[model samples]
Target: MSDDVVAPVATAAPATHEPPARDITDGGPDMVQFLDADGQPVALNEVNSPYAEYVDAIDDEQLRSLYRDLVLVRRVDAEGHALQRQGELGLWPSLLGQEAAQVGAGRAMRPQDYAFPGYREHGVAWCKGVDPINLLGMFRGVNHGGWDSNENNFHLYTIVIGNQMLHASGYAMGVQKDGMVGTGDPERDTAVMAFTGDGGTAQGDYNESLVFASVAHSPVVFFVQNNHWAISEPNDRQFTIPPYQRARGFGIPGVRVDGNDVLASLAVTQGALDRARSGGGPTLIEAFTYRMGAHTTSDDPTKYRIAAEVDIWKKKDPIDRLRKHLESKGLADQEWLEALDAEADELALRIRTACQQMPNPPHSEMFEKVYAEPHPLVEREREEFLAYQASFEEED
Candidate 1:
């Protein structure tokens, strides 16, 4: 291991009923953190020096922009949660606390880069130029997915756990075959990013994708947002070793970053992506963060986790940290902050209005996209379904 990378220390597992008490604030010595929990800058150190140049390249305007992204993304999450509560959506997965992780990684990609995201990557979608309303349409049950994946190079949200990793691996291999990797031409070189949560690491698909990506030398990065829970299950239930450490077994370089620190997230991800574009194969980035909300509208996080744990993580809120940094650095003032908050409110109103105005597609519309060309079997089923509906209408 390089001096920058620290090896994992194994600890005895606690009893089944009583899980080990984790210090939520600490991301361990190996985790790269450019900003401390209080939003103060951490001076360049061994673990973070490799990625400092990336952060240094960001200008004052860009720093403020990142802070804006963080604020708006959190607002988006609040709206999504509210919409679900009002029965506007069938189901909604809240990205309440993972905004920095998603936004940082999203902004690191070039125009040609592709992203395969798990369902809750709203922040990534936003950074990739995907409209917030488009995301809401899916949960509202009005459309399969609201946007064309090809339009923005952001794939439709994948609902199945870890499935998108395989898709991303295959896509990366395809990009390699197309001579997109290691091309000195910046416009031609491409890298793929696959996003998943902590629970996804336990899936066979995730492991298999890594194997293919390693042997094929595919240009891809696996970003695991270790939000500390896979639904109700904690990290202890997922793996004995952290995801980044396990990347070594697959012959890939692994790094852990403080997910709440946007600068660290952006810098580290940019480095990994640069490595991938230059034909360095894949890297696994485990972003140490927390899910401050329920797993979904259907979940009750309070049932499984204690309020104290949530309170501890709240002190490290990603948005609050970035705002503090901006204020301390004189990059923003009260008036500027208020204006951004107003913009967020406007965005929330727009999202709410767009969602309520979405037209529900006719049930028969499902059959339209089942095949590119007309098929007798589908036609038969469509007719049968319509006839069944007609019989109910007649009775009424």
Candidate 2:
């Protein structure tokens, strides 16, 4: 081939190089940590540590309640997964881990504050005082959502990734317009929280929400539960910069916390939400955590990741860590722990029974809410559906 004929330019096959190694120290500068993997208490720095005061505020009773919440939430999640496997639920998104992240954030919010959750926020729901059976109803196909969002100030679970950020931001703006921010009255002042996974940060809505919140100084906290995987894709594919750092680009302050450490999660979330309620503007919190189970009941983690990695994270089990800490401090004993286990078993039984007893909605129920006023097409369809059902009945 002549030089003028330049052989068809060979393009190197897309680089199959593995992701770059992440630097620990610099990669996570804002990581607010209160406990180590071994459940040992770590000293707090008043100047640099964002969560020191929050962690210091916890008493023995609250510690025990946190443990109980963790246990019960785990049990609820486990039962939901089992019910799905047994064909009782259409699907289940197990919060097998990350209990600490959800519970801590959930517990920190004031009753007046509002929460917008991703689908896998069972622990948060538990903290909001939603009945466990109500959660199972949605999975069982009996209701669109189990609880009333207004009643609990907890919005329905949002399956669409990152959409809740927009909703929460809008709600926060509404709260501001209504003069609910910086009232110095905890009972009247309100802030909004939006929950999302690490992958959610990649969505346009997330950025748009941040822009609006930052510009308006809306009373909202954007909480990203960085479970390391957005479904099968790892965090590296979504973005190289740490999620918390990304907030700086949007002009919102951010902090990263050891999500597995419940106390840290609680403290960080509380701090962010408090800032929002105080008219300080939106804040972003990246709770660095892991997903121990499949993304959902339909997923198989073994296919994409190795067992050794899971084993490593297992050692950092949130529940186990907290339990050890409590035991070591003489805050709880074997007897109390065993009693909690018995309560968990009873809760599991109740969940199983309630899930099985849920009534399936009638076929016509779908048409009932299609329109505020009766539409000709919907009426015709409803009639046709009922006729079809009648055809299945025996002739008398």
Candidate 3:
């Protein structure tokens, strides 16, 4: 990644009377982290020991692939943000510093498992085989969702905050009833994963979904990418305690992982998904990461946050950490890394061209999907709309 694309850590602003927000840079002792900010491996301790086996089992090829994923996903975010700025897209929610949190959890899922994502899970969508162009259509105002949800076992991006949790819980209950859990068959057993943000934890739907999943013993994983700020609100405004620590109240096992550490994120999420698939019920995974960009293209972080905080997280960039690990371990060479960079350039161009070429949906399309069967009211509205459009054409 270029230095220009990465936001620089600025000097801290003059202190104010308001109390300073909690320093969440270090995810506390309980946070599972395999790779430190400098890309050095940390000594395995009781907190992270259980998840270490999963990371240890990863082959060299898999490690290189993880690096590739982190790079490509970041490129995707960069391109999307650029497109929004260039007016090709109406808006974009950047995954920025949260690449490892999304990709690690995303790669852990099997083909049969389903995912319910919030609007910003572009990294997860990429891992689930959705074309980057498909993701742009919604932002471009061309379609409600550009891909089939069932085709990839990835649901459409839910714009409503925390709503997918309820959807995922209900689907998990159905999967349980269908006898798809604990079948002793790897291919048949299925798990559901719901993605949300730190702010989502405050929503009533999020709590309700936990209740439903707990009572039903549903095979689901609630993956919360706690990126510190909930839009303009800091973590202090959202909760009294970290999300992972609060999961116990719901009778679900919760684990906090260093969201910037791809290996740790993958290992912890894999463990949780494995447990759920085996009918162990639901688990909550709090990926302790940071959002390096604005909440969306429409948001301006400078108005609400300090550049110092962004700089702290920037040192812990997921892509940089993985790249360092690959270099130090001899998993990827300079030539291969350069080629991957070239590949990212190609990907960016492809998506940019695709976005520019996307045709706007017909004006009449708004009325097309209102009902499965044609309704008299809808037909009348369509006729009126067409007449209105025709009147404009006559004047032109």
Superposed by TM-score, candidate 3 places the C-alpha of residue 284 at a distance from the truth, in angstroms, of 0.4
What is the Cα-based lDDT of residue 347 in candidate 2?
Answer: 94
RMSD of 3: 6.0
Give the C-alpha miss distance for residue 357 in model 2, angstroms. 1.0
- Worst 10-residue stretch by lDDT in candidate 2? 5-14
lDDT of each: 0.90, 0.84, 0.89
Ranking by TM-score: 1, 3, 2
Pairs clashing within candidate 1: none
CA error at residue 294 for candidate 2, angstroms: 0.4
Error of 1 at 392 (Å): 4.6
Q: What does candidate 1's lDDT look like per residue over 260-377, in tens digits?
A: 9999999999999999999989999999888999999999987787777678788999988988888888989989999999999999999999999998898888888787899999
- Candidate with the greatest TM-score versus the true structure: 1
Please give the ranking of all candidate structures by lDDT, highest first, separated by commas.
1, 3, 2
Between candidates 1 and 3, which one is better according to lDDT?
1
The C-alpha stretches of model 2 lying farther than 4 A from their native spots are 1-29, 46-48, 372-374, 394-396
Q: Of the candidates shown, which would achieve the greatest lDDT relative to the real structure? A: 1
Q: Give the poorly placed runs of model 1, Cα more than 4 Å off.
A: 1-22, 391-396
